[model samples]
Target: MEKSRGMLPRLFFFVSRPVRGTRGPARSTHVGAAGAFMSGGAGKRTAGPGRQGSRSALASVRAGAARVELERDDEMNCETRDSGVVAAGRAMTVLLDPGTGGAEANYPTRPITLVLGAAPGSGADILARALLPDIAAEVGQRLAIDYQPGASGNIGAARVARARPDGHTVLLSTRSASLHKVMYPYMDYDFARDLKPIAMVATMPIVVVMGNHVAANDMLDAMELARFNPGRYVCASVGVGTTNHVLCEILQASAGMRMQHIPYQSSAAALNDVVAGLVDFLFTPLSAALPHIKSRRVCAVAVTSQLRIDEIPDVPTIEEIGFSEAGADDWYALMAPTGTAPRIVARLNRALNAVLANRDVRQRLARLGYMAPG
Candidate 1:
């Protein structure tokens, strides 16, 4: 129920587009000559030929309102009135005027791209899709959900980080996004530097489930089994450096046990292997592992939340098993590239708060074992 506070300004690259063939009063200014300045507008005409004859030329320069547009064809591009600016043979540009006002006034001139860092049907993906309708309705803009799954969500996150900070492209990510820096030191982008946290969406407890082949009935039993026969048991996680993987590591450290770590690319694959007894146990989202537990395909050991969840009240928590420090919750949040405009971030935070405040949205999220932010 905690809310995000304050607003942080993001970086923006301004591109000046002059009206073609429209001449106005001449204005002189001293600045760097880099890109092609088209004819027209209120600016002093530089000594350059018209657009038809020259391959590259500097047009009149003026300090006017800044506009940003998204280029869908390429991953991302930064356009500035500096060196090496190419105006010819470029994609269509949709101008975003930041000086207009708040996000409600001048944002989302186009469809917003909601990037999911996980595979389809995964917990993160499901949550992102579920919240789309309500968010789109509140924002008056359709959200285009894009899936970029790989490297435990780093690939998708990287794309968002490199995207234009026009609030059109944002990412819906989990805690795993923050853990990537420590896990993968050679990564191209830094999560904290490239991605800005907008607002928290929901939080859920991770359930510990064991296959039928395991004799452990509870977390205590699982710890004992691992202690007695070290390395005989293996735990499966959605991927390396994920929340579930970290939870397993916490459990191992807290319980003084050793087990082989098995990482899978997707939750479905990890769950399937766990059900087949190929992997002894798994710590996964309740929504993904609940059906298996109910069908008797996997034994519920314990949840990683500090308190028992309503969806599976019978499943004890890690704190209840005398390992309070091992408790961890899986959380999802809205994020944009660090350079996104402040008004856009504020607008997104407001819209998300409105959607989360909806009674029906809360009920739907609760049914999926997710706790909506207050």
Candidate 2:
């Protein structure tokens, strides 16, 4: 007889009544019963005719129970598979959906604050103000400037670090942001851990300017005078622990010279003293020193960059004068409080890059003695 699909021939055992002390040999009985039913397929079975009738009823009961269990297992597996697909779909949607994943999608729900770590008219402040209009338009929000100048920009940076990490408040910081932690080890907040760098806006070389009273004609002469006069001459910086102050120290050490360091509250004050002949010399930002240099109020001796600045090509770099180790440059960048959403940081970076890419903006920055980094 042909076997039925999804059926297996089950074997059953039976024995004749055992004789007195001896057991009769067991006889094998076979019955055709349906095997575990599988989806889209069936099993085969075979059996002898002699015992088929005897064990068919018993085999049918066991086979029926197994079939029910297999069917239940198949249903459970299908449900689990479907649930896995749904869960994966939900995760993909969350990752790809701008409303959910993109923090920049609806950012700056309120007016944004751009914090400058320097006084008004300082290099950082000027750069921040210059880029504000363009960044504001790109972000589609009204932007406000907040000046928190103190501790060589540490005060302003700490304020931003303590602010909520919601992208509403950001900082326009300079190299002082990194220098302050080392210069003032007792500070309350950590610079590296608290601030996140968004993008570098512009960089300008620090120029070494001397008051008109100084007899030095160039950097070589100035160093010679400082080496011999030592404490007789004085050097001014915008503030203690600032890039200017540090650069002056480096220059002194490299040249084996000594000069009095006068720290002013702002670059304007320092530059004012330099031009007025109160301070012998100052290491200041190009932006702050350009106007005075042009007016011949303060003589531009040398720049601290590797290359000469285009605005004042006549002024050679420190390296050109053989003081290669004294080269220093100042830079301004946008930063947010640590833990600000990455999407927001990316958005701000894009806006800054766009602003710096404009030809007119580049020209304006160039006139201020600032250059966009390559």
Q: Between which residue pairs do clashes occur in model 2?
A: 6-43
**TM-score of every candidate relative to the true structure:** 0.71, 0.72
> Candidate 1 residues 73-99, lDDT tens each?
111111111111112223221122334
Q: RMSD to native for every prediction? A: 22.4, 35.7
lDDT of each: 0.64, 0.64
Q: Which ten residues in a row have the lowest lDDT in candidate 2?
A: 85-94
> Lowest-lDDT window of 10 residues in candidate 1?
74-83
1-374 per-residue lDDT for model 2 (tens digits): 01111211111111111111111122311111212111121112232232243244334543433221100011211111111101100210001113323346688798899998788888887787777888899888989999998878988999998999989999987765664544566988776667776666777778999988889888778888877764667777787656676567555644556567667767799888887777888988889888989999999999877677888989987777765545656767677887877677666666666777788988888888887643
